[model samples]
Target: MPAKQRSFAQTLNAVAWSFIGLRRRRDFDEDVGALNPFYVIAGGVLGCALFIALLLGAVRLAVA
Candidate 1:
């Protein structure tokens, strides 16, 4: 029998989970619980900015 290969979406999900510390289950949960609302808001804003930048880059390439 052969092992199944991970899909691109699964790989990306793993990467994002690791980045947010979910790889360390207990610590990640505790850290998330301890996080302040302001920090959460800041992270949301940063994520939005990053997403917007990617979208803009794609649009520019399409226009070119």
Candidate 2:
């Protein structure tokens, strides 16, 4: 989400940054215009799934 459409990796990186709950205003502005909405949505879903899986795994270990 620079001056051009972001690639898959770039999209994921952006998604990751968002997940962390902090973003630079300059980057946010760039992403708002240049990042694909679909890719962002898909990346968010994938990230959430992975986070849930890791959380469940940790809980299982702790319980065991």
TM-score of every candidate relative to the true structure: 0.51, 0.90
Cα distance off (Å), candidate 1, residue 11: 21
Off by over 4 Å in 2: none
Q: RMSD to the native, candidate 1?
A: 12.4
Q: Candidate 1, which ten residues in sequence have the lowest lDDT sum?
A: 1-10
In order, what lDDT does every prediction score? 0.58, 0.90
Q: Clashing residue pairs in candidate 2, if any?
A: none
C-alpha RMSD values across all candidates:
12.4, 2.2
Candidate 1, overall lDDT? 0.58
**C-alpha displacement of 17 in model 1, angstroms?**
4.0
lDDT minimum window of 10 residues, candidate 2 = 1-10
- Candidate 2 displacement at residue 32 in angstroms: 0.7
